[model samples]
Target: MSTTLILLILCSVMLSSIAQIVLKTGMSNPGVLNAVQSGVAMQMITTISTNLYVIGGLTLYFASAAVWLLVLARVDVSFAYPFVGLGFVVTMLLAFFINGEVLSTAKVIGTLCIALGVAIMAQG
Candidate 1:
């Protein structure tokens, strides 16, 4: 891959990871669910509309999609898709550190595997 493609892949993965983190932070506020079993979808919408983190995260997702489209035009989907796996690794570590979420042995192993898989595909 060229330098530009590599950069795009990195940007795509980083944006995705950051978006996931921000969304999780926004959703951490339990009240955001408002009315679940009651089946009032609009309440959920209202909550999301009002949450800055959620709004920002969703916006980042759109931005990522736009860049990802450019990336798709430039490279094979199979080659590019594996790069997204890095998002999982990024998210896992962020969650563990930022949220104080658990980082079990299994999770560590799984994340390492994702990194390995992406590297394997990148070699091809």
Candidate 2:
């Protein structure tokens, strides 16, 4: 693949990963957590819908999808889709650093496997 294609795919994947973190941050807010724990659907909807982080995350996700469309137009889905798995690695790292989430041994192993698979697939 061309350098532009590679960068575009990576950009989409990173944006998606960052969006998940942003959404998680929004949801982890105490008020959002309380709304969720309350089990009132309307409260949950209201809290989430009005959250700036959630809105920004969705916007980022939309941007990622737009970039992904460009990727799809240029390459085979089979060739491009595996790259999405890279988001797992990206998300894990972001979670670990940004959210202070634990990075278990299993997660490390799984992410390594995914990275290896993407590398192998890219060679085809």
Candidate 3:
């Protein structure tokens, strides 16, 4: 893959990972949690739709998808999709640092495995 294509794939993955973190942060808010617990679908929708963080997260998702479409146009799915695994690693680290989530040995091992898989895929 060319440098530009690699960057594009990485950008898509990073945007998607960041979007997951932002969505998690938005949903973790007490108000959003309460809305979820309320058992009212409309209430939950209203709460999430009005949340700036949620909106931002959704926007990021759109941006990521746009970039991913470009990547799909330029590369084989087999070659391009493995990069999405990197998003798991990025999300794990973001959750650990940004949300104070714990990183167990198992998770670390799994993340390493994912990184290795992506690297192997890239080399193919």
**Cα RMSD for predicted model 2:** 0.7
Model 1 Cα lDDT, one tens digit per residue, 3-41: 999999889888888899899888777777554444688
Q: Model 2 off-target regions past 4 Å?
A: none
| lDDT (10s digit) by residue, model 2, range 20-108 | 99999999999999999999999999998999999999999999999999999999999999999999999999999999999999999
Candidate 1 wrong stretches, greater than 4 Å: 33-39
* Alpha-carbon shift of residue 84 in model 1 (angstroms): 0.8
Greater-lDDT candidate between 1 and 3: 3
lDDT of each: 0.88, 0.97, 0.97
**Model 3 per-residue lDDT tens digits across residues 1-124:** 7999999999999999999999999999999999999989999999989998999999999999999999999999999999999999999999999999999999999999999999999998
TM-score of 2: 0.97
Residue 73: error of model 3 in Å?
0.8
Report backbone clashes per prediction. 0, 0, 0
